[model samples]
Target: MPETNPQSRTGLAFGGDYNPEQWPEAVWSEDVRLMREAGVTMVSVGIFSWALLEPAPGVYEFGWLDRVLDLLHENGIRVDLGTPTVAPPAWFYREHPEALPVTADGTRHAFGSRGAICHSNTHYRAAAASITTRLATRYADHPALALWHVHNEYGVPVSACYCESCAAHFRRWLADAHGTVEALNEAWGTAFWGQHYTGFDQVDPPRATPTVGNPAQALDYRRFADATMRENFVAERDILHRLAPGVPVTTNFMTALSQCDSVDYWAWGREVDLVTNDHYLMTDGRRTHVNLAMAADLTRSVAGGAPWLLLEHSTSGVNWQPRNPAKAPGQMARNSLSHVARGSEGALFFQWRQSRRGAEKFHSSMLPHAGTDSRVWREVVELGSTIGALAPVAGTRTVADVAVLWDWHSWWAQNLQWRPSEDHDARERADTFYEALYDRHLTVDFAHPEGDLSAYPLVVVPALYLMTEAAADNLRRYVESGGTLLVSYFSGIVDEHDAVHEGP
Candidate 1:
């Protein structure tokens, strides 16, 4: 329902995620005026408005949102309406009390941080679905809405369920997969040390402090945990699609996010229409051509080189990174162009306006403390002018002959390793895989197992330790059809269960 359609041909959408909630309602008009002056065309809204939208359970308020959307619409800016589900309201937590996540260190987290909900908790899932459905139904016809942003980032560090519901779901998942406790015992290698289970209740998540542990059991739980999170994303997206027809649904992904696999998320992505990712180029350590190029290339590749949205970057210094340093003169411009150089269809920052409080108080924005008179704002205006001048080259696909497989679930599974080799971390090996391919002059794209491999002439499968039979069969099919398949060290060692395989 946005004023402009995703022009399908070429030219990037230049803008940032705008949170008007951080500022007064009086600044709405000025925000629009400044966006037009700075060349911002799209804004992602409602990302952290969960607690604001529903302060009390079963209660909803849309007055602020209505004004926010209307203001953006009046200024000819498009809106990517984020479903307000990432951070639940205080009321939900106050009543449910089981929404907190248990960390790896055996501490149950308080409700201070965002994204601290157990995805598999029945109550959490119900609340999330209700909120998402309400969002889809209400804004499905809003003319300013362009896309549906499911949640900010799927797997945050705070929330992973270790509650009774999670334990129950884990058992159900295992039972469904292996069919019985006896088969589960075999797959988990529980026959050793008399650890065999007689019932489903005997299974507990691999405690961070393992005692006579089965490596395979821990591995399977890791897989299930990651899958459970992905299932949550899909559930919300599916609800949105059914309620809001024709609008493209998406979730902003973090590239090379080790906790949740974008490769696994691609299967969920297939259900949704488009894909976008966040690439924050913080710290001088990460300010290299190699790092920037890889980040951009990975973003493009995540959607199978379908022109990814460069979501949530900083216009200047980000306070969260260790030793936050401001982007040097021309650094912001250079970084923006780097995405274009690799394969980003559009580039957007984390914020359009500055925040006054919270952890992101000092984070960079299009408008700085000096307001629109500062150098940062000037650079933003100039970049906007440049992008506006060059809108015709938006949807141009990158020339990629190589694909590097990156899976988040598999990465999590690998971390569950009790005593891994020096490079057992699949993510590190993935970086190496990319470096090798880049050195070979092959323009590489990130390939999800569920993504189309038919396009690439060559594919590098890195650390396929938890290689599923389906994935292996897919690779075999790709190779049989003349695709150049490269499986690296630690390949074909384990199935999805982390069970050691008898090499063929």
Candidate 2:
């Protein structure tokens, strides 16, 4: 009902992920009624609508989607339409073998979960762009549409793609960085056991035996993969940006997932009109607010301290973890409030209504199994009402005193090669740094490697395994200029090429 903007003072946007596609048209009105009862102001529709939209490639079905959008419009709910690239239609994947993701073990994954496509596939990008373009062009002027939700949770446990296209691109990337194979060989420390590459193709991604061969090589490939995925996000969102010029676009980022470097994700955030992310803390985990605060601060930092939407969070409990944990009676409200206190613009749950089947059937929602009368639903409604009443208080900022260098390249450099210490995993190290800063209420933002370093009073560079000479100089200058810098144990241990570097 209101125009959405970074500065728009709409109270914390409170709603859960909605899927009108799951049920028949007869249930649409009932869902809308329930949503209004729950005080839902926004709806993230079509997160998995590839199958619904393009039952056949190039054939668009707007009838069902049209009804869904129009109904929500009449009900005064904003829609954040997902691009649906995470789960391309089965027909598209079945026809385009290139769309399949290549695992580190050289296995091509079959379609099962969302985010299964190889980020390096050009054909996948083209097809995905076509669908994204269609959505943007059709809904550009639709006031009901508030944001563009790019590919759902682009996690990457499938490992890096060594497909021909990716391989060629990797080689070109190497050429630009190292100039020649000999230079690459020296940089990756190929002389360790005569693992030198004669040319770019000789370099293999970290997988199977390659990870054991060289940590530096493996690290660079990890960097490559991170960049590749970020590029995919940028490529897809750029289409929407061009076609639908006014709407804010963002991918829902998972704060500490192994699938991507958050630093690289920050790079992808530059293309987004605003930053949005999902935060799910295991109810049993210690200090859940630690990472949650870091994520909120990181989101604000990515958008230049602008507010970001809390895209998706478990309404009651998460089922994906090894042991699913439900949020305690007042925990959801506390968690949502904590995010706002720490600096989130708004908080949204994963699903408004629980699923009836599929992997997520057991996941909690605002409308639980007992229908809209359940406690979960009631809490959601109450929170929604409160947010509506306190919209002005919902969008305030948390002024951060600390800045952490969250360079994905550094993450790739450390883990790409085989490191002896398993505890020093990039994600873990990044979390450790964030947790330390957060423990002191020092709001922190993850700075991209290319971001200007002059903004923060304090900068922490943790576990910089692979850093360019230029980046090192930037840090040096920052510190020399009276900026308080905290370097971790393994800082600047490797060059950009992944070769180990000694102390000064």
The alpha-carbon deviation from the true structure for residue 73 of candidate 1, after best TM-score superposition, in angstroms, is: 0.6
Model 2: worst 10 consecutive residues (lDDT sum): 1-10
List per-candidate RMSD values in Å: 2.9, 2.9
What's model 2's lDDT at 117? Answer: 76
TM-score against native, each model: 0.90, 0.91
Task: Give the per-residue lDDT digits (tens) of candidate 2, residues 1-504.
Answer: 433442232666778788877777798899888888877878788888899898997999978888788888888788888888888888888888777877666788788766677777888888888988898888777767888888887654454676667777787777887899988877777888878788787765665773366766666676677677778788877888888877778888765433235346656667777777788885446577676666667667767777777877776877877888777788888888777776666678888778898888888888888886677877887888776776777656666677787766677656643476867876676778888777676767777545677878988877766677887888888878888888877777767666666766
TM-score of 2: 0.91
Poorly placed runs, candidate 2 (over 4 Å): 1-9, 157-159, 257-263, 425-439, 448-457
lDDT, model 2: 0.75
Cα shift from native, residue 85, model 1 (Å): 0.7
Model 1, span 214-235: residue lDDT tens:
7777667766776788788889
Clashing pairs in 1: 1-143, 10-394, 10-395, 11-393, 11-394, 261-408
Q: What lDDT is reached at residue 190 by model 1?
A: 82
